[model samples]
Target: MKKLITIPLLFFIVFPARAQSSSLEKRVSINISNQPLELALKMLEKEAEVHFSYNPRVLELDKNINYKAESRTLDHILNEILGPSISYKVHGTHIILQKAPKRDFYISGYVRDGESGQEIKNVSIYEPQTLASALTNTHGFYKIKLPVQQKDIDLKFSKKDYDLLIQPINNRSDQKLSVELQKTIKPKVLTAEVSAIKTPQVKLDTTPKIEERLSSNSKPQPVPVPEMEVKEKKVNIDLSEELAFIDTTYQKGKDHFLNWLMTTKQNLHFRNIQDSLYKPIQVSFLPFLGTNLRLGPVVTNDISVNIIAGYTGSVRKLEVGGVANFIRKDMTGVQAAGTLNLTGRSFAGVQAAGAANINLGTSSGIMAAGATNISVKDSKGLQAAGSLNVALSEIRGTQIAPFNYATRLNGLQIGVFNIAYDRTRNSLPIGFFSYVHKNGYRRLEFNASELNNTEISFKTGVPKFYNIFNTSFSYGRPNKPLAGVGYGLGTSWKYGERLGSNLDILSSVYFQEGEFSYLDQHYRASLGFEYKVFDRLAVFVAPTLNFYVGYDESLDFSSYKLLLSERTSRWLGENARTYTWLGYKFGLRLCNKS
Candidate 1:
């Protein structure tokens, strides 16, 4: 009987380890500043290099719009991508978009002296057609394509150093012309016999004979020619030829470094990491394989494009892989590590770890990990990732979760604040979002969440997916959490991924199907910050002030808004919002590729 019982327990235990474990994730981000509607549209259409449609007129809720662009969206995506690019006026329930200016297919050409055949180098060339333009090359050849509005058009040409040339074109002839550049004879040059006295280069245009002194003392050596130093005015002189600047050396250096990282895919281990934002830390290798392509601008002249691809998996641990810029911070109050952790990786944008770690004060980011850490935490850009921040204190915002932090609860999350009973409210069912950045802690996150009259809060700085919007809405039940009903929603605005503190205005009225006279409505406007406190932790605090306008007669919404925990270690998740008690929350969250 004992042997049979052991076999059954082993079967159930091993099954979960072999079953569903992880989900994959792809990410993209674009940042476009508030340029003019027309210009902004053109930039996105012509510069956003992604597989999406670039229709300024099309509006889809949560769909990928493949488009192509030439310029980089690096900075634009830093602070403004959480909302729509173009704002529209709402007509009742409908939204009316602003109309954009019309453009033309421009036509442009050059003007050279028909006789001397001398092409103007600094020539002004314009097309009445789309206003597109180009100057003539040294060979006098120019190329241009215009968005012309009308068939009959006019092309204008004028240069500060050259005469103005205007030509009219009709259906009569193929558009082309050549005008002579009459020599620009200047007034100064025409007047010859330039006396050295006025040249200014002559500090003392001295000719004792040229001046007849009336002074009695002729021997007094005429007022010592005050050696006037006419500080030479650096008149910017435009060189006659365009300079062919060479950057071959720098390019070669950058290429060599990147090539080494790509080609030399040997297992590498790094120890003793001291970064600006976080404390000291270490990372190992989890041998695996995958691929990654980071098509963002190399603001750091280090490299332009980053491509990391490989696979990683520990002998008795999870597999890890992914490509990204590795940024770390120094650890404070160091604690010695217990045993060796597998960090060997072989993929792009991914990582995995499994082992007991002892971190006294450390900051790090890991993915696909099953770590039993005594005090190890996951913070990106200085902010935590969940509503019930496990150990650390101080957090803000709503609806954020670190994919599997609540994995111990399966699909259900059950955790709370500090184990000690402080005036600060402890366990409440709140969710959080921590920000992940390019190099590491360049930015942080803010999030908020409440459900089934349980604890729910938000913080800035978190992660999202490839060109996807983000949003989450949940229902609250005060008394019974397990039996209570719940609903949640997540979405993205505009193109998503741009995260900075911008006033977010969201309105939703849902009469959730079922009993309980459910009409939930809220108006919350909070300032958010994506901060990088240290290498290991980035915290974002937005003291929010919101108003609950809509009515739910069957429920006292305010009570749930300020949920308090009876036991300092845990409480109902829905009470995160309706109940009021100075609560101290800390988050320890994790995210993998997904």
Candidate 2:
């Protein structure tokens, strides 16, 4: 009985130890066919009953692996799957995979032109396998860090207008290489000659055949040869002569209006019986019945004086007309007309007209018109019109009119309404409504004020200044809602990259329900700070000082009250016509221009 007990105790102790050791040594059967490393590891984890511990970045979990194991030990299977670059460690019940650390070294260099020895900027130096790249700076310096591997690394250098360079680096030691790149050579043009030869003439004789009389060993007489003549000729060509002829024909065909002006001047002068002597001064009674009207189409050096009207092909000095003056070509001197002045082409002198001034081409002098001034192309001087001024192209000087418009404005436009298709740094449109297609600012705002609770506002102008139009409705404590309209001027000052301040002055009129005649007027000045959340969206908060003037004493003032009641009461008398108070406004802005 003692021997039986000893045997059972020995078996019990040995069996438990063997089972505990065999738990970790358990065989796992896993078959993963071309799956991601993460998924394959998960399959192994389920079969082997082991957890994986690793940093995902170091494990390269996205890499694919094809692993198959049948009744194999987990350690053996892991060694078969992971290559030398990766290592694994087995703990109590976990498998840890990690990437082998590598020693890295740097490569720095300069790239220069082989011919001129000048540094080349923006050269790309890259390694294709690693997807590592470095660009040369302005000083043509480049530095790149690479891992120390056993295989050779290929680096490629390339730039525009230069030949490509590929270099091989074999070691991990830091290196400083100066590389010179050759420029690509352009192909040169070569001239070749082609000769033309006329075919030789062959004559066939059909006369009676004569038998040859010659000895068998003697040579026959040589046939008579025909003389051949060759001739060579050189041709001379002048391109300028052909071009001049074409230009003259084009000019004559294009100047039909000029021809008419010349014909009219000659015919009118002949009818007036003017002397053949060249006279610089001539007076005309009417457009075609003038002293200078008989002058040739283009007056070279003549001062035209017209009592009522004048017509000329081209004016050189001065033209004065009582009613109107018309020129077909260009006018170089001062032209003044009682009614209107019109030029078909450019006008280079001062032009003053009582009614209107019209120039089809460019104008360079002061143009004053009682009604309107129109220039089809560019204008370079002061243009003052009573009604409107229109320049189809660029304007270099000031334009003063009730309405001014230009394609490109390089100067100031002072009018009630101004429009510029292109705006420059110096182009300023100071008016009620200034619309610049290029550099103007436009925004839609929703604001709140003491007098106007909810206001919808439209603001437009340049970056420096803008005009505001506001319409608000207050429905707070008043028995009937009050509606108000306001006009204001605002200026902005930028403080930071996304912060700005705005100063505005506004005057508004509020009208009560069923009473259109009686109105309350309020003047307000505000300073606001705007924070731009996006390129097109902004939020603003402002502190305002308001002066309210009540037209009706019985109207309720509760709708136009603010938080600073204690400070406002000190200035408000018992029976005061105007009262001042502090107010606050918060709003959002949607900008159409940057």
TM-score of each: 0.17, 0.50
Off by over 4 Å in 2: 1-279, 291-296, 476-481, 495-497, 554-576
lDDT tens digits by residue: candidate 1, 1-594: 999999999998876544322100112233445444344433443433322223455433243333332333322331132134433333222223443343434344556764577775645455433333456666666654544445765655555544455666554333455556555456675556655565445476665553365444557555665678889789997753432232345445533443344312121111100111111111223212211111001101111111232211111122212332321112121112222122211111222223322222233332222333222222222222332222221121111224313211101212221121111122122233222222111111224344222222332222211111123333433422222221221222222332323333333333443644444544344443433334344444444434343233344444444443222111232221332222222222222221
Q: Write the per-residue lDDT of candidate 2 for residues 212-287, one digit (tens) a residue.
A: 3332456667999999787777787879988899767755654554345444424333232222223466577765
User: What TM-score does prediction 2 earn?
Assistant: 0.50
> In order, what is each prediction's RMSD in angstroms?
36.2, 38.7
The TM-score, computed over Cα atoms with residue i paired to residue i, of candidate 1 is 0.17
lDDT of 1 at 100: 35
Residue 475 in candidate 2, Cα distance off native in Å: 3.7
